[model samples]
Target chain A: MRRLWIGLTYAVFALLIVVPLVKIATGSLEDGVSGLLDALLRPEALHALMMTGIIVVFVTLINTVFGVMLAIYLVRAAWLHPRIKGLLNSIVDLPYAVSPVIGGLMIVLLVGPDTALGALLEGAGIKIVYALPGMVIATLFVTFPLMVREVMPVLQEIGSQQEEAATMLGAYSWYTFWKVTWPSIRWGVIYGVVLTVARTLGEFGAVLVVSGNIMNLTQTATTLVYQDVENFNVVAANGVALVLAAFSVGLLLLMEWAKKRKEVH
Target chain B: MHIEVKGLSKSFGDFKAVQDVSFGIKKGHLIGLLGPSGGGKTSILRMLAGLEAPTAGDILFHGKRVNDLPPQERGIGFVFQNYALFKHMTVFENVAFGLKVKKLPKDAIRERVQSLIELTGLKGFEHRYPAQLSGGQRQRVAFARALAPEPQLLLLDEPFAAIDAKIRSELRTWLKEMIERVGITSIFVTHDQDEAIEVADEIMIISKGRLEQKGTPWEIYKNPETQFVAEFIGESTTVDNVAALHGFEEAAAWTGTRGLIRPEYIEIGKPGEITLASATMRGVVRHIHFRGSEWMVELEIGDIRLITYRSLEKDVLKPGDPVDILIHRAYLFNESDSWIMENKLKVDPMPVII
Candidate 1:
């Protein structure tokens, strides 16, 4: 019975993942290796890939710091009123509930050029609407929950006993965190970081809507692939999509590896 | 260090965990906060360790009020019920944590940790992580870690609760002796009266967030000041009435409303086997439970049932056998006070006033 179920699952996996991946790989090589290289090395493709890299690094860094802190606050801060803590917990998960396009729209609505905050920032020489800053903020809004969600369960599982033991032994709060709390939660934080990196790298709808898909200014890799398909450049689109798929596959493997490490602990 | 807590109380919202509890610990004495589960023994320990803020109280260490001191500033050692060893760190690193926090020289830290490892009998297990150690070993690591900084007082919460039955007794004796050798004022919480009686120099009985009685285990065992203490400190069962029992006429003046008796205080034997068989009451054995080294015989005398232990040397008792029962003494208590009621035949009979 188990074997039959496993075979059926493999069949579905092939149709959904294996076949499309093979098709993308073949399609990207349609003009041969040189043609594929030429399309990928094009100035616009290079710029979009660079934009995606920058966003992934910044978003992961910001998300990891705030996310771990928020998770700790949510789980350990006894002084917080339960209702307010519950509300904040749901707010952390808001990114998962709202559509990425709507998240992008919300960010633009709140901080677009014509909005008061946006106008003030723009007057202070900060262009946010069709710029890298807006792309980062929109992506941040969409992927805000990943790290916090990963770390919260871990913090809860380990409980506050060891931390209390550390403090009772005359460890300052920071030292207790680094010595007792951090080591236990490091795997959880790493798993969250991997998830955040993957999500940031592949973010599309929000980045496209917020970045405005300007040629070289804020056009991320996914946005550029959309523009390629829109302009009847299927070969270039396939090349960019192939790269994104490969990156996603690598991230998936990294996530699995991180998960195994976490379980071992 | 001499420790004093003046009206320390703790509440979790509507639930009062520790209420208006106050006690003192003489220097270098081992104390046990003994109580039933959910009876607020651990809450008092946490407050003493500075891990929980008291709702209203003054905690003094060597005559200085430490109510505002953070746990780090309090310089106390705490062993949690679960041990709470750092899973990621080796036993050596776990013990060396507080020393490293003090930024001591590496050699000093190594020497101290090494000595503690030997002291805890975990010499070869130093490199192993907490996951690799047994429950008893993990408990030792917790003890070593807490003692690393040589804190003023050590607080342990239910120290032997996580261990299985066999090793628990062994660890209890080991912990009691280790605390004596170190001679640091220590307080441990336990629901197990045996653990407290066997381990602590002084035992404080707590119930419903209030201090019931505080004394040497012998004092609490022989002369419980409150009904709760008399009922809680041992395997005591409440006797319905003391005046109806054989040779207990003096109990009438005591108004023994809630009479409590310990199994060891009640003697059960074949009619002539009991020394004062003439003054003994008649009871039929109801059930016999094997208690490892002794037999716990349940007996029914008139309207009430009693429990008494028979040594393995005694002839086996059957369920329906009639036996002579001479209760040596029992505790009698009313709402406001309690007193010990002796068997009138064993002591000089006093004139009953009531």
Candidate 2:
């Protein structure tokens, strides 16, 4: 009976997930090599892929640094009251609870031309909404919690004993953090960065709202695929989707490796 | 260097962990900070290591105030209870960490680390990570790492609390030998009285964040100044119980004061010779248990009871056997936790008053 139940679950998973992925893979190559090349090699699609790549890299870098700092503060700052610490801990996971569309709308409200923050930046000739800056911010807003959540647990588990030991051994605060604390949590940081990258690559709703889906200026790969499907260009859409799936698979492997490394420690 | 702590106190919010604790550690002595759990021994050790800032008072090292110095600047080696060796580094690297941070020459760091490892008996385990070592080996690594910087003073917080029972005593002896070889002034905290008595050159007993007493092991055991110390340092019973059993009304006046008598001082006498010649009070053996090479006999005199230790080779005394016990010696303390006088009385069945 247990085997039958497990088989039924696998069948459902296969029908819902594996079947569509297989169909997309086969359908993308339906037009043969040249046709597939033509779809992916189009100037607009190439530009869109490059835009997506740039935004993902920028978001991953910014979020990784900020996420690690936030996690360390949450774990190590002794002066924070319990209530305030709990509030901040919950807010770190705000991105996970809030929808991406709402996250994008939040950025739009803060940086659109009509708002004070947006008008002031515009006067300085800094473009946010409908540009690369706005797209990166939107993606970051949705993926901010991934890295912090991953690193915070590891930091909490390792505790401050080793750090204190280093300080007692004539190590300053910076040296202690670098030599003792960082080594213990590096795998967690790597895992978090990869998760953020994976999430940024697939981000659509927030980027769509903030980037305005500008054809050549801020049209990321996801928006490009959406636009292609709207125009009944199924071949182009499938090609882009297949490339994203491959990147996601690579990211999944990296995340798995990171998790394994953490367990060994 | 000799160290002196004057009026040191630490408070967390509203709770005072260490309050007005003052004591001096002489140069080149292995001192034990003995206390019960939550007795603030660790807090005092942390203050000495500069890991904790006392809420008030001064900490002096060789007459130089170090209250404002950070832990790294204090030049003290601190070993934590859990043997917090760097998990990511090998034993060699862990020991060399401080020297490397100081930017010592490569050869100097290597030579210092190798010697310290050998001193701590971790010579062959230099390449092993902390996780790969046994509990005792890990403690050795922690000790080696703490000593690598050639610190002025060494502080350890319950270093043997994590070791297995079978190896704990061996490690304690080894640790004492190692510290003597290093010849640095050191302080370690422990809750185990036996470990403190066995390993410490001088013991400072603390309770409720206050220093109860400080003296050599024999001094502290034989001449405990406070009621807390007398009860905490060794196995003993109150003198009031002995006085009450013998109907000494004057001795009852010492109640709410201090008086202690050790179990080993009292001995079993023949019940048939019940005269006042050699027995203070007569009682029946209530219980008996073989304790190592000795028999722990409990005696009941009316409603009062006393415990005594006798050699197992002595004639076996069974429960319900009436026996007379002789009171050998007892110490009395005043309200200030100071010894008032020693009352050495000859055992006699009389209403003897002190």
Candidate 3:
């Protein structure tokens, strides 16, 4: 009975996820291979690819640096009160709960031209809202929690014992981190980075609202797919959508490979 | 190097784990900090290792103060009770960790690691991770790691507690021999009196976060300063109204109470006039346990119960047999019941006139 239940659950999961992918593949194949390739390699499609890649790279880099530091601080620092720690931890998790569009709106409200900081920046000829910087901010906000969540549990499990041991063996704090702490969590950090990249690449709602879907500049692959589909350019939209899907799948595969390697090691 | 711990104290919130612990360890001696769990032996060792700071007082190593130094800078080696080896590192790398951290050349590190591996009998297992080793092997690895740095002092915190009972005895012997070979001043913590006796040059018995007694193992076993230490160190039988016994007049005068006797010193079926005066009750044998060369007999002396050891070849007494017991060489105490004095042996040592 248990095996039957498991099989049924897996069958349902495969149907839910794989059927649409199979349909998309068949529809893309209905067009000739050269036509599909031409549609995918169009200048507008290349612009969308470049824009999404830039956003993902920006978000992933910022998240990795800040997330690792945040995780280390949360685990090692005692100056922060427990309530403050909880508040900060929950704030990191806010992006997951808030809708991506809502996240974009929050960023706009805080950094838009009307706000004090936004006005100050705007006075210096630095445009943020409805621009590349705004899109980066939105993507960062939506993907901020991934790296922290992945790295924090691993750090907590490794605990302070190894660090203390390293220190006792004459390694200073920085040396101990470099020698002992970093090696233990490197795989988990890599896994988190992959997830963050995948999320940032696929992000559309927040990026669309923040960047105003500016063609050839701010329009990401996801946003361009939305535009193509809306304009009834189904083949071009599907081709770009396939590339986005393929990149996300590649990232997922990378994450799973890292996870398996960690388990085996 | 000699270590002098002066009035060291540590408290965790409201509970004082170690209080006013002051002791000096002479150079080139293996000292055992003996205590039951929660008796602050580990805390004292931690303070010595500079893993923890005393809430009060200071520590001096070789007459130089080092209370504020970090563990690595203290030039002290520490072996944790769990043998905290790095799970990912092989035995050779684990031992070489300290050398590498010291920024030694690669060839020097390799030579030192190889020497330590050979010394620890881990030559064949040098490439094996800690997870792949047994508890005793892991303990040896921890010892090697601590010793590779060639620190002036070494601290072992219950090093053999995690090993199997059979291996623990062998490890204790090996550890004592190893410490003697290296001749580095060492301190090991243990609750097992037998382990302390077998390994330590001097044993410091602690109770309730305070030092109860500090002496050689023989002195601790034969002349415990407190009832807690006496009971903790070995098997002892308390005699009620011991003041009435022979040679106990001065003891009775001081204590106004009874005294205790170790089981090994007690003899059955014999008593002198004054010794008879202390013989308050006759006992019936409850059971007899043959222990290799000696027999341990449990006796029911009226409502009280006592155990005494006799030679295996002595007259065998069964359950319900009546017997007379005497306190041959007993320890006397003061009014506080703290050990005041001990009865001296009367026999002279045989002369070796070669």
Candidate 4:
């Protein structure tokens, strides 16, 4: 009876997830391997992929440092009033609910060429909207909450006792954090980084709105796929989608591995 | 090093946790901070370890004011109740952490850590992480890690509270011996009287964030200075308005004071004859409980209930038996709750005054 129940659950899971994934993979590979390869190595496609990589790298670096700091402050800052702390906690979850297109629009309104701040930034010789900076900013806004949410619960669970113990052992505050607090929260950090990278790689709406999808200049892989489909080049569009699907699968596996490592430690 | 705390008080918003508590510790003496939970024992320990800043007061290490120093500069060791061993590091790495921070020579650090590992009876377990060790072994690792830095003073917060009951007693003795060997001035907090009495050379009792008494274990147990200390240290019973309870209206001056009595001081005897009995009252035996080698006899007179411990070698007393109660000595406390020595140790015979 248990085996039958298990088999039934597995069949439902396969039907819901595995079937759609298989369909996407096969549809993307309808063209020959060389044809897919030809489309991937094209300068436009390569540039778009590299642009996505640059954005993911910069977003991961900035958000990892700032996200972890925000989490620590939220959990450890004793002087913060409970109401304010609770409000900040709710704010971290805001990006998850706000639409990516709305987030890009909000950034544009704040830093668009017409706004005073945008004029100031432009006067300083920096372009924000319809540029690389705008794309990076929009990507950052979308994935900012991932790392903080991942790390906050783990930081809360481990508590401050270990850090206090480190101080009592004649360790400086910085040393205590690096030696004691870091080890406990490192896995959460790795998990958060993985999720951030995955989300950045696939972000389309916000980056599309901000980048203006200007061919090879600011167009990312997702934007390129959209452009290809618009030009009625189905095989080229499918090629980029296939690569993204592959990367997402790799991230899922990485997440699984990280979860196991966290359990062992 | 000897330590001194003057007017130490810590307040959190509207609540005061430690209130003007002052005390001193001689070098190499292991003291126990005994109190009920939420009694500020932990707050005092944290302040001494420089983990918690005092709201108002000064802390001195060997006559040098260390109130403004950070925890690392204070050079103190702390053992948490849960042992707080680094979950990720091996035992050897945990012990070597402080040495590494101090930038000790690599060889010297290795030698010191190896010896401490052996000293703590964790020789073979050096490679194992804290999660792999038992609770007792984890406690030893925490101790060894704290001692590796050769701290001037050590503070432990209920070191044995999390251990199993069977192992708690064994660990208590082992911990006492370990502290003696290390020769560091140490203070540990506990609510268990037996643990405090067994492990500490001196016991400081606190309640509701106020220091009640500081004395040797024998002194605190036999001669507690306040009503709270008297009952907290051991089994004790207190009678409010002793004059009314004993029906001695002539002794109305003792109206507001409470008479503190020890269980062992009261005895049961035949009703008619009074011999060597300073105070006598009549009560019926309500219950008899067997406690190890002694039988605790519970008796009730009017609205007051008293528990008396009798040796198992004596004849057993059953329930509902009428008996005369004898109290050899007792303590008297005034309305302000201070001990009134003048009215102590005396109980006049009833003389059918009622």
Query: Model 3 reaches what TM-score against the true structure?
Result: 0.87
TM-score of each: 0.93, 0.95, 0.87, 0.93
Docking class of 1: medium
After aligning candidate 1 to the native by TM-score, how far in Å is the CA of A6 from where it should be? Answer: 6.6
* lDDT on C-alpha atoms for all candidate structures: 0.89, 0.87, 0.83, 0.87
lDDT at residue B232 of model 4 (Cα atoms): 89
Candidate 2 C-alpha lDDT tens digits along B268-337: 7666553454436678899999888888998887876778888766678889998887655666665654
Candidate maximizing DockQ: 2
Q: iRMS value of model 4?
A: 0.9
Return the TM-scores of chain A for each candidate in numbered order.
0.96, 0.97, 0.93, 0.93
Question: Which wins on TM-score, candidate 1 or candidate 3?
Answer: 1
lDDT of 3 at B232: 85
Misplaced by over 4 Å in model 3 are: A1-11, A42-44, A76-95, A125-127, A156-159, B237-261, B270-280, B290-293, B329-337, B340-354
| Tens-digit lDDT string for candidate 2 (A1-265) | 9999999999999999899889878878989877778889999889999999999889999999999999999998877887899999999889889999999999999999889999999999999998999999999999999999999999999988999999998899888888998889999999999999999989999999999998877999999999999999988889989999899999999999999998887
Best by lDDT: 1
For TM-score, the strongest prediction is: 2
List the DockQ of the predictions in order: 0.79, 0.89, 0.47, 0.79
Model 1 agreement with the true structure over A1-265: per-residue lDDT tens digits: 9999999999999999999889889988999998789889999999999999999988988988898899999999999999999999999988898999999999899999979999999999999889988988998898889999999999999999888877877788788888888888888999888888888888998987888899887888899989999998888988998999999899889889989999887
How do the residues A1-265 of candidate 3 rate in per-residue lDDT, one tens digit apiece? Answer: 9999999999998899888777667666668888689888888899889988888888888999999999999877756877899899889898999999999988889888889999999999998987889999999989999999988998888777667666667778878777788888888899999989988888988988888888887888999989999999888888887887788788888989999866654
Q: Compare candidates 2 and 4 on TM-score and give the better one.
A: 2
Q: Which residue runs does candidate 1 get wrong by more than 4 Å?
A: A1-11, B250-256, B268-278, B288-295, B311-324, B345-354
Steric clash pairs (candidate 3): none
Docking class of 2: high
